[model samples]
Target: MKHVLKNALLLFGALFALALAGCGSSVTDKSQKTASLAAASAEFPNADLLVSADSVQKSLNATDLLIIDARAASAYATGHLPGAINLQHSAFWAKGRGLKDTDTVAAQLGAAGITRQQKIVIYDNTTASWGAAGRLFWMLEYLGCTDVHILDGGWDKWSADGRPTQRAAVTRAAATFTPSVQGSLKATSARIAGRLYDNDFAVIDTRTDEEYLGWQLYGETRGGHIPRSVNLPYAWYYNTDKSTLRYQQLKTMLESRGITPDKEVTAYCTAGIRSGYAYFLLRLMGYQKCSNYDASIWDWADNTSYPMDQAPNYADAVYPAWVKALIDYHKPGSTSAAPPQYSYDRNHKYLIFETQWGSFDDMAHGWADNSYLLGHIPGAIHSNSDVYENGNPRWFLLPDAGLKTALGSMGITPDTTVVVYSDSNIFAARLWWILKYAGVTDVRFMNGGIQGWQAAGYPTETTINTPVATTYAGATKPALLASTTYVESVYNQPTAKMVDVRSGSEYSGMISGYGYVVNKGRIPGATWAYNADDSAGIYVDADATLRSYEEVKSLWSNLGIDFSKETIFYCGSGYRSALAYLYAHLMGYTNIRNYSDGWEGWSTNYVEDPAYLATPAVPGSTDGWRQDPSGRPVATGGL
Candidate 1:
């Protein structure tokens, strides 16, 4: 067997040569051709059954050599290596089946001047249609061709390296090709069915997740894969750029999926095309006992007697025990621990509000709007919070009259029982703080926000609601809202703690928040109290619920923050900071205030006044940063 690491290096070297071949202008001049020949010879060598472009170029005048382009007819007609005959890969396919009949395939090859005695070289575009050359090579080998070889990097390397090309078609005199099929190299449906229960056999489905899981029916009588088959998409073998195979990565991926050399592997896909690539890779990697199920799932599914199975989709695949535990913990009603008294459930008889920040259409890219449009608690009305302030000059809270007018239009009254939620819990928290600052009592935060409600199987709607406009008697409350001056005063105070609840990236002077803040650094002397989980957006559990009270409390306690001091929280535009304020209040902190303008406020003020910028900006440090008790960052980067 080939050493795994050695094969990986070889693959990388071949890919590097192909990448270099595509640079600069084509090799047209004699000097360029001479140089390219020398470079190609040094970079690429003829492996067992793999030929280099230079070798093929050097042998173009040999009468015994026949070069075949295995790409589409259109591609071949565009430009092809000189004297190369077009034998498009599709011509080798069995009519209405995955594999061609041995006699028919032999005749087709003979018509294309492919004789058993002739030395054959095959190629296809390396990047676009993967494995075409490999498939042809496999078929030719199975037919017992004596001298067949595949171009190392196929047409891509040949054309990219500035080899000679011709647009005119090349016709070859018909030659005889004898049928000498190697039955052991191909698996039939009946053979695969009989080996299904054999411990030594492994059936690999080399299709996409959608096909393997039956999520899509692609030209099959039914969806899903052959029974007892494992899915290993062929694309996984290639690098992200699709330039070449990453052999070590491919080996690790296959091994993880239980596709090892120990088993008698039979690979298949929607058709045999992709599986042919798998067959080539397996053989090249020295997996001695492997075959291609040429008929694949297409023929297998057409027969009613053949059994098929739809494996679990990607999301439903098995996860580790710890992941399962976390998932279970976040499910609604799974935890018996009480949520904050101020957090409300879906059943609460209050006016629910969804405080999203963008236009309805912007929701597709911006997580906030998309979540609302996809599904929101049935009675919740959308609130575009951006319209509540003059954001350009500065994000200033609306005056009492403007606030009252907006609330009245939204059907909110002084006695209204308000329940707020947002996809980004921070948005909802900000709105809650805004309502409280406007002196609206009886306000409550949804414990886990809209995601929590959805996870609990609550009904959701996409329809927009038109509220019955009512007069809201606005009463401004000054204590809940902290001004910029107040935030500055508490920044380094011993009895008062200012918390920068933005992302580490935002606090570290690495990036400015939302491009509105002129400076990158945080307010000097403020502790980094943002839960690591909030880094992605807002901190939420596996099921999108807020973390448990104990979990959240521990986050602050580890940062040396407690209820003993007057706590003030701030984030970009005050949204996330408002969430921190809400959490602190729920954790029983006596005096909590939200710097509503947040980093945006402070930074904008500093930008407007050079003196504020000169006032010695705080240097950011992770010293007091909040982390999970286990020392892991709480915020995962994905949903």
Candidate 2:
């Protein structure tokens, strides 16, 4: 019985090397395989699989050898292998996986003079081709090719080494090519489902982090990654300049991810283009126990019960790709960035504003050519905050008529679902507050700004967008704004909780946080709710997104701010306060107001502190503030 089992195991190993039927298993000496995958091998275990440029150049005239450029025909037209045939990578499979017919592929190879036993070599432009050669190499091997190899580092390496290339294509006499489909080499959806919970199997996701983390790139019924799968982006296998990483470097990096040879592995991406490269990498690393999930999430995501992880919620914000999706609707259509729950479909009416302090020219003075600061999100109109402010020299809110005209010109109706973003959260919140004060309902703020958008692998636009005017008609929500007298009336009362969203220094009367403000000190009867001075520190995450409502509320609660009453938020000139107020609105605090006058107005009533008045008023470049001894009412050091 032991002899029979040994023979059966040997037979299975031979079959697995020639085929992959998703989850089909093969085994080698586990100890040697692990050691080889960890750079212990002086050379790659399957080093011969990667032929260098010199080897290929020397073999160019061999009669039995076939060199195939696996790049697009357009790239081949310029230059390629000396005697290579131009085979566009798409011919290896249909538009995506699961659509190719094996028999049809066999016929294609026969027509191209490829025999099942042909000594074939494949090369792709590694920098641009997303591992096209690797895809073909794996496919050829799966079809029972006895000897198949890929150009190491692909065309990028060859060209950099100054190897010879030719523009003309080559032809050979047609030959009979028989197909012996390796069922075990291709992973089926059923096989992946069976092994998902198996301890001995490893599933690798080769898509981008956003895709793995739930930014749906394709039309997946749902977003996110396969449960229990490990993320290792396909791009990581190569350097930033597109040169392929050596086997030693690659194995060392992958060692941390536990892609060891002991486990049977299945790799996948959106539709398997990237994972095809992944499959080749596994083989090149001498790992015999692996297969490619060709159909991948294209088929898996269509089934709702597939049990994906990290799926996005309905209320989650949209991403750069989503911006591209909607940008498709505009003729001069949208900018680049990337999507969430507030659905970003064309069916949803959206008024997107790139709010800034001044016009593009005015902003260019500060930003210069900085793309993140100067460019706008796709499908967004540029709206200047200056346009909505009265010439009070202190950025006071414009009259209702002026507000209506300014908003209408930007095609913003009271009911239009609006999204505003700027250089920072403060500017976005300022626009959010202004729109709400102007009676526009359902205003949204993207806190990450354009910098965050670009960081997510989306795009921005320099082309200006034209806004179609709309006649905005809505009753002004007067209660949302807190005038100085209105704030004084309710601030000290038990019914209202004043939240000072100012810096500790400003709240303690040491210095004003703003450039124009001359007086310091917190508002009377106010609590230090948020200590963010310019609105970018502890309240914001490292990724530049705002803190969650749960986190913000916890911080506010710790500061003794009450949620059961009307909350009035104030800052130097209401800019910072608007950000705090917007967070409250998002957190479902029913009654909240932004003190439009802020500390700039409140300081005028209290007498300046005698000690500060006696000291010479020195200008501070950092804060751009100088205390005034002009007998202005100064309310110093309040809780």
Candidate 3:
């Protein structure tokens, strides 16, 4: 521990020094008296190559350049160019995981002394991947920061060139920056919906061709791109290995796909961040009319009213002549269709009974052969949890309103009781969490699910029953939802135990990619566990449907966790932890809450709002500081 701490401190010092030296004296150079740092109209220089540390040093003397470190906090803290402020893309942009709101972003930029007139220089630690760096540059452009440049080859080039570096944090004299809001650069959900079928604008999906065609996305939900959107994944804007693009070649490729420099082009993706990259490239290439749909496909698909053509099911549909030509020209392979996105709702009261079977199909077969098959518990619908959510990687949050609409279409009334039974409600637990998050307050997981129901000799139904749609007005209680504020508050107070169901590697923050989070660890004082650990034996009898209090106690004891503590379960996006949440409720944990945003939301953004923490102060801050644990004073080392 001592050795690790010593190394960490040394690493932190080296990073601080490098960031300071990278900034140079241009910012403090009184020689450049005409350009004021606070004005939005100040003259800013435009430079494309910012990779040379010496050039970076010379450039910083101009007072008009703003240097941004586009890397994870840990990386930035270890060693960065001088005078650069950490402008993490995940923390500064990505939506839903917090930091999506425009006002919040502007505020952060303002705090960093970034003015529209200042040339923003952004670089990453990677040799070529510009996932976060490119995203931030695009965001700055959207905010009307006209003079921005990327450091080609990023930190790798600078280090290899043996640029001067430091071992302290960079401090800057504060400068005020005023922002002028511009709406034209932003594309809202409403706007994207309006243009979905409009022929005047070309809709380009910036995800993989497979994802664009509605195949599986991120191992979570299924379905393809927006009905008619063309697949020109952001990666297509670059080389095969995704290092850099052949601008003319890419332009010609897009032109053949009906995307002309003069034509209006709009891009989308799972969440719009990747599309931001396309938006930037379009502008870089002098495309006069281009917009990135920020809400992207996730929000679009969630809105059921939005028309989308089903992606040709890869299993049954053959490649079309047009698409096949493109496939052969670039790469040979058919785009797969995503699986069905099981829309959920809180309106229906579903009761499920679980029965013993070695496989899911065997259990279904057993239920089919049983007397219960002749007649199910009145008003109960049968569904397997596996069909509802994709289990690996990260479970995507089901759109709240989509769930309501889908349930209503399924003949489920808003107030109907839903009891789901499986041998053990283990899998059913996901539905229980989905219902609650969707605003369905009256939901329960059959303790043992079908297993317990079978022990009671409950009848099942082989035939499906269709019911009428009912209007369900669910209560909107935003307070119960996890926001940045709530996460910080609960974490600080220790009044709640934040349970992480992801593996320790994720919880410890060892990830390296876009949307890669900060803090490099779980929320301080959180309890970590895996959902797979206690699921197998939770259901033993029909009466076992209710969570056995003893079982819950044993599970907690075995893991050295305290269930009596107010609980808040979370995973990548509240998917896996949901199983724990349901199990806790079964064991009678009444005060448990799930951080829907979970680590994905919390880490990507930050944990500063008081509402997020229950305590007034964090546990291990230096001298009780309120800043992030991984953050240091911005001025510990200056240019």
Candidate 4:
């Protein structure tokens, strides 16, 4: 049996190598398409597959080969190859599993019966399912596991050819796997901070070209990418599988676009999550000096001091032909109908205000508008968009205690019936989410914003004096928030509605950034509603005069959305989507939730089964594509 397996492996290797190499033209380029043991042996020898079913079948004997299965337990329970050990990916990366901790992973391998002497073979459903398999492969190599190989097409490929299978599970005694850290693969924020100006390092802002061009805003901060940073969107690496890249092809493609292996590269996205994936790819491709900027674009944009550069030609440049094609693909026709059941809930009533005191710039403008020493809202208290106590620049979530203090300092209290507004609807919605998370209810945003108020001839004081300091004390309770976990569970369930207010390409993953890969589709059940358009020049809906209920329902339903269910809205950082939330509130939806972290949050902290929305996939008709006065299409950059 051992001889049969060894001979088959050798034969398969020779045939595959010959087929992939072809006649003359370089073996490296074409071999990228087919699985090659030669390529594996050369770049990632320690990460190569050690055995296959062919070896077992052809040799009629097997010894010294470890077969590992990477799949969900449910999938594994159904049927897996004989002698294959199940190693689910999600389980290893549980909440407490520190991905950066190499020691823990080494110990895990040791427990999995991995050893230096034995050969290892790993397989999964496919390349996409290979996420766990790939991570495991990387980890094993890091732990000095040589003579290891990944099943080319994974289990699906094996089964496609009618390979042998067994139902019974077999357990083996654990083999010790120890890792000694060797490379500079992981990078921290503090480390990058010191190297910000180091010319030897080139930072790759792995966000959308639009974001790098300052076309869209992140959180409540302005839009623009880190200065001197090149845009090599992380999504460019993967094919339809979204798990493995054609390494040789990608290496060449990236090099042609100026990402060389010799240069020190640092990658970042909205938060560190997407960039982490990019960081992993760089290391896999033999790039020794690559690390992902975990804090990502969000952290960089948070601080005004961080240097930024906007691509000069983005606004005026003609749209890529593909984008124009996308736009023309789904132009909304007059036949589009309004939602079936859409109307505002008359039970809710509150005076929503639009203020400009959420940020230092907004605060300055707020002071200019109402020269009062006191902060904001007439009967309301102060609420900055960046209220997180830990000081994460993107104004990310904060603990209930910190939120309570921030609210208390601003005179917020339970039963306040608060009205929040800002220059950006996200800040208002973020505040609303935080308040709700902290257990304060009855919140509303000025629909038309401060502009609506001033336009409506509402009150404003220039020489405003300080008001009496009021105490705000609210308790933390379950009713107040949709915790991250709660949000995740609700999101995955078929019952919840996820609304993405970002532009069409962004929602579709055609454009990367704000923490997601391009062409990868959206959250499983998310609906896209571009942005808030009102008399206030495209501000997210804030005042009571939102789009008519008929209009809101029609807009979403035309996009194939079911309006009668529970809904959760989000955008880059919960701003524009707040307008959708306001619209839902106005439309009278009883169960409304907002993923405050929104796309930024979801893309960073959670991974969902990819589900494509059935709505129009057109560009301009959707969002992300811009039309000029002459009707020429253009790439608007960020939305």
Give all candidates' CA lDDT scores: 0.66, 0.71, 0.53, 0.52
Question: How do these models rank on lDDT, best leading?
Answer: 2, 1, 3, 4
Q: Between the candidate structures 2 and 4, which one is better when assessed by lDDT?
A: 2
Residue 42 error, candidate 1, Å: 13
lDDT of 3 by residue, 1-639 (tens): 999999999999998867765644323444642322231111211223223344555555456667778877777788877667776666664542313666777777777667777777777764234356667776787777767766655666666655644445565555555556556666766776776567677777776534544455454234665655666645445442333454566566667566777667777777666776777666656677787776666666666776665333221111112122222233324353322232233222333332212233545666433433445443445443333233223234444565566555544454554444443333445556666665664454444344334433554455644446666567544543565468776775756677767655565556411143333456666666643323333422123333223344465777777756677777666545666665565445567777765665554433445655445354332221222533311111110
Each prediction's RMSD to truth: 18.5, 14.8, 28.0, 24.3
Model 4 residue 183 CA deviation in Å: 4.6
What does candidate 3 score on TM?
0.41
Which regions of candidate 3 deviate over 4 angstroms?
1-61, 93-101, 125-130, 156-175, 219-222, 239-243, 315-639
Per-residue CA lDDT of model 4 for 1-639, tens digit only, reads: 999999999999998777544521222232232222423324432232323434433321245556778777677777777668888644444322124466666667678777765666666775335244555554455456656566655666566665556667757788777665534544545566667677677666665444554545346265666755666554454444333455676676557545788878877766554455456566656676776554455555666666666533233111122122222332344233221111223222223233333444555665333322343324333344455433332334666667676666655567654556554545555555566556665554443344444433445433432223355576765432344466667766778777777766776666634432222245655666775523233432223233323334556777777756567776665556655665565445647766655554544322122331233243322122111112211122322
Clashes of 3: 75
Better of 1 and 3 by lDDT: 1
Residue 40, model 2: lDDT of 17
Candidate 4 ranges beyond 4 A from true positions: 1-62, 90-97, 100-104, 116-118, 125-127, 146-148, 159-162, 165-167, 196-199, 202-248, 266-284, 291-639
Score candidate 2 by TM-score against the native. 0.54
TM-score, ranked from best to worst: 2, 1, 3, 4
Q: How many clashing pairs per prediction, in order?
A: 4, 31, 75, 29
Candidates in order, TM-scores: namely: 0.47, 0.54, 0.41, 0.36
